[model samples]
Target: MSGMHAATHRRSGDPQPVPPSAGRPNARTTVTRLLCVGAHVDPAFANAVVKECIGEVADTDRFVAPSYGYDVLPVLGHALIARNRRRYRRTAILISPFVPVLLSFLGMTATIIGIALWLWATWAAVFLERLITLHTLVAHLVVPAPEGGRHGFDGRIPDHAALTQIECDRINREQDGSSGLVYYSGYRPFVGAGTWQTSSAFPILLNRANDGILPPMDDRRSPGRAEVAPFTTAEIMGYIQRRLTAVLQAEEWEGQRIEELEIARRWYRTAIGRVRPVSPKDAPLPTEQGVEHYDAAREYLCVRVGSWDQEVVASVFVNLDVRGRTLYTETHRYELRPIKAAYHEVDRLPTAISPSDVRLVAAKAVVQMAGEAIGAAVTICTFPYHLLLRALSRNRPVSPRDQNEFGAEFPARRADVLDYGARRSVREIGQAPGAHHFFQDMDVKKYGDIVQKRVSELVIDFLEERNLDTGEYRARQATILNQGIIQTGSGRIVNTGRLAVGENASA
Candidate 1:
């Protein structure tokens, strides 16, 4: 979204911008519908999204968790919307004069008959049909319903926007406006399936002619030639931040486009061990404090480009350090891929109800009802085992807060007690095996190139303003910028001549 076609004429080296949402046939619709009905259809996926995306942290608190893409609220609340719509239909049908009531009665009878066939019939074919039906239903729900309802998955139908705002406010209040910092962990929230990709460093040495001939720049009175630049790291950082922000946060030319992409700058906090920001609130620190940390190499510039309603986020973290009169610019770009494929099953159901819709819904539900019956039978059979396990298990239901207050040995705040590598990323979980066409491979490359190039260019510009010789910087920039990713025989895309690779989940 940042690199629209109109901006292409601005610079020669700019990556041509393709429509961000292209190559996605009914993908957004399917995803939105799935989001709405996932709670009832696929409880596990719904729960994970709600916990990791909507809810800041998982119940078992260790690593920090935050959503990176797709407004989780609209999707999470889709179930509620669906439930309300169902309630309304039932109400209307019950109150109708005769025709609708009769139709509703017939539909209900047919559904009941379909369920009974699976639950009661002992024939192997019946059982098999039930199994297949349940499998299909578990994949997605596509119930036939009327159009233009109060709340629906149609793009025209508005979701619970006001309610979503209230819910978000409540969550913010609960967090007390401070996001947690996960210390001693290499895993990051929403970073898709790949190692963190880093660009070749661009060094700005005092004497570009002789690469490694300079003494330590830390000393005020070193034996060398010229004085330090008339700028501090903080000043240059602020300059870059402002310039980059102005460029990326373009005003929407298309008036109807809501939630235009915005650029935000935040301090990339770090410690001796691995550390990452769990929530946006945890990202920012006071400029003075941030500069202090940056001087000590404890912070980096986190330039984030959130597009498509934050469904896709490209974060380029730029770390700058001055060592021995050489200003080193190291950049790492992390991307959050589109939502999972399982959630895209909504397209199977069209907007309007048809004969096929009824058949599809009925067929899918038969096995699901049968599976419920089968599950009940299993629960009855495992009663004794469940009881034994419950009695033998030492783990009791106690909130961490309550346990700590009641004299628990380990403090709940102690994150280092038993560190687990990353449990799962909100974006990574339930993701499609490979990058979906919604976030096409081309789009990924374009976004990365534009963002990374802009960041590097800004850094070079900042150094140039300080009267630094950028001969080496320009040469390094050409090499690094030209090193676009290429696909290999295994279908994996890697940086040309570098180990850094894109988050190709299939690979």
Candidate 2:
């Protein structure tokens, strides 16, 4: 019965033990006990060694625990080490009566070493916990929040009521810190139980030398209410139109198209007004120009319109010249006016406008102008507008799905249309070449395959210099991880062994 019990304990692939007749337990039990004890102790010893090594290398109190949760390996190692130590002590006592003195000494020595190592490991763990907590506290206090305490709204807007005087002062202070001015404003109508009021202020405007006073108002009152008259729609429109026209007339557009001219006008009307004027005699006239010339004209118009602003506005002129008698007995020539105003008015005054707000308005105006120009070019040139539309539509920064759906009607490429010098410059230097290079070298492959592969390598290098790259980020990550690793005494020994192994493998 004893032999059978021993046999049951034996693991597969182990040698058989002496029979009960030989005065020993069956091979199975002996093997089973050896394996169980070794399995438990070996791991515990390794962990203790690692912990001691780490403690010696870094202050345990400085180590920070991971925020996610506790790591299981260290905890498991601790439990196994204690179990194995207990088992080893009991087994040693049981075998002392039968074992040789030399073997017994070796066993005792191993147990002592194990206890010492475990003590060191425990000390290291405590030290690491303390270190981590200290570091975490320091980090928390030092590291600034990414949003700068402001949240929910777009970063361009400011946090204030009525663009108040105090807010303006704060904005000025911030701008002075950066050697520039930053304007912010918000406009919202107020509605109450039985009345409405429009309140607005321009913080920067109050300090400006050119800013004027609000329009006159009467203090007429109802039976139980106060009243005020706001700036009317006609006055606002007239002011905007006059300022915009003046700005446009002062700027120059060498070979701008009708659509571009329209965009500039719209931008002036919507945003801060800016305009310049050009004589018809100075405008580019048709001189038996090819399709390339026409395309060039279109491109020039697009750029001029898109780039217009209060500080930098442009005006375009076109002159028609005919050498021979006209086919229809008269030359057909008309200046195209593509953009028309559809105004809306509110009873309340608008809030102060910021520069960023103006930029957004200008961008929208430029887009509108481009659309109108393409439409007119197609009508006059008697060519397909789909291709131009698709290309320009793709240039916009929006989702791929939206772009694809919007450009679905156009072909992938079109032939027989020669780009003029102006168009060529716009494509090669203004937009396509730089944009194509950026996508080709980007770690994230967002652009289509055609653009990625076709972009020049030189351009890719330039783009990398201009923008952040993956390689630099990877190097930084490696440095941070190395700094994060903790090293104790036994861990150092293991690490040395690992280094040797790695070097040998590499060699």
Top lDDT model: 1
Q: For model 1, what is the C-alpha lDDT against the true structure? A: 0.47
Segments of candidate 2 deviating more than 4 angstroms: 1-46, 49-70, 73-505
Off by over 4 Å in 1: 1-34, 37-41, 53-69, 79-168, 172-186, 189-212, 215-227, 248-261, 268-300, 303-313, 354-356, 395-430, 484-507
Top-scoring candidate (TM-score): 1
RMSD of 2: 39.9
Model 2, position 328, has a per-residue lDDT of: 8
The lDDT of each candidate is 0.47, 0.25
Residue 112 local lDDT, model 1: 60
6-29 per-residue lDDT for model 2 (tens digits): 222322212332332333332223
In candidate 1, what are the lDDT values of residues 361-386, reduced to their tens digit? 56765555455555545665687999
TM-score, cand. 2: 0.13
TM-score of each: 0.57, 0.13
Clashes of each: 1, 31
RMSD of each: 12.9, 39.9
